[model samples]
Target: MVFDDKNADQAQSLREKMSGVRNGLKVITLASGKGGVGKSSITVNLAIALAQLGIRVLVMDADFGLANIDVMLGVQTKHNLTHFLRGERRLDEIVHIGYDGVRFISGGSGMMELLRMNEGQLSKVMHGLTKLDMPIDYILCDAGAGINDNLISMILASSETIIVTTTEPTAILDAYALIKTIVKRDNLHPLHVIMNRAESKKEADHVLDGFSEVLAKHLQKEVNRLGHITLDPEVPRSIKRQTPIMISAPNTSFARDIRSIARELLELPPQKEPGNVFSRLFSGLRK
Candidate 1:
């Protein structure tokens, strides 16, 4: 599994894209229209895969009400994101480094705490988060399902959003609904889809086709397919073992799929400026 020169060059380009941004953070928020679609599973392993490729990754368990990255990763830390949010500790102090060298912050069943954050507290928490000194290459926010204010804010602030869904009709319809809501409400960031628990390649293609059809016909938005993860027993086995499938069953079908997805993600071209030279020059001068 050697990364050739081309792959290395693309990874470097991606790093450069993050270099100009403050905090060196490329935030990727993972959301779902509904649960039971393996959203958290994808988020955890994706972060692990990136880290395995020598990228500094952080999984912010932003699921808020139902955060479970810690359990999935077998982390039994005392502190959580709420503790940092409440100013009880620093972000680094609460982050639990996993076996794969990925760092994660637990969401901590802090239902009331998250719901009660006043504007001032929220501002302080955001400020604290910005102050984290690690050269974080990516901050993967695993957001809970549904359309909520917090979820919307996460999507808006993220550099990219990965919407997870399955081939089921209900899941596809709900995913389209979520995409429609994001376009209507935020309408600024790019969104990608990941078809999870897909029974077959054809089913995954069908899911992506349906999503694209709906978004194009109704919302007039062009959504990108980030690829799909097949349904594999290793996923549940790893879950029971409290370890990531990428580590526990790296050769399994789903693990191979995830690795392919990770490689594809690494090969993605950097976001290009959407203008000619003169426009870019003017925009740069304005900045």
Candidate 2:
């Protein structure tokens, strides 16, 4: 989208607002290099799990491929980044509240082409994030799977990233490639990994160990093993019901596993000034 003179000035104003938005604000981008690894699903449940522990969380659906989070929560997003950029809605006003008060923002839809936005469009959206007034401990971005400038930009802009992958060989390799790409692009980019749909904890541990070794050996990068989610039949059932497992079956092992990952994520310190983006929404404190 070409920004007119007035739009350019407004975007500049939003960028200026970003200067005050980084009071320990934590923005974590969740992604994968391959699809069908349940990245979006985990994004939804993990946000809810964190909220269950009283950590206010906002989940942004950056997965331009599809609004899986929306379908999972059975909620329709009437507004998105475009709306916020148009001056028709505040960034916070476009948020779609999901399970357990976990706020979400749709990444546009249909012709909106969320991922295809130009640099100026993306800059405006990123700057507008500071408009959010509600207190939030974490802003989890469920980035669309695979490699692209948009995906990489989102990850690099966030404080850190959590890459989700399954036990499949292709999935593991793709995850590694994605991580290596990030490190190659910016050696300091913090990254973590989550093994989804593992058959068993033993296997999960084995795979994580091997994967960690590969990363350390090849890329000289250290990525935390956030945790794993084992295969669960109920996960599909919950999806069919349009309710996340964290809400439909919080007592189940699947939900408990998500909570474990959330706890690990809580222990991570927020970047002092993540990419100099996301100014503090609160005066002196955030995150």
Best by lDDT: 2
Off by over 4 Å in 1: 1-24, 115-127, 268-287
For candidate 2, the lDDT comes to: 0.78
All candidates' lDDT scores?
A: 0.75, 0.78
Compute the lDDT of residue 24 as modeled in candidate 2.
65
Q: TM-score for model 1?
A: 0.82
Q: Write the per-residue lDDT of candidate 2 for residues 141-215, one digit (tens) a residue.
A: 888777776666667666789999998899999998888777865678788899999999999999999999999
> Which residue pairs show backbone clashes in model 2?
20-280, 21-279, 21-280, 22-279, 22-280
Q: Quote the positional error of residue 82 for candidate 2 in Å.
A: 3.4
TM-score of each: 0.82, 0.83
**How many angstroms is residue 236 displaced in model 1 relative to the true structure, after the best TM-score fit?**
1.3
Q: How big is the positional error of residue 38 in model 1, measured in Å on the Cα after superposition?
A: 0.8
Which 10 consecutive positions of candidate 2 have the poorest summed lDDT?
269-278
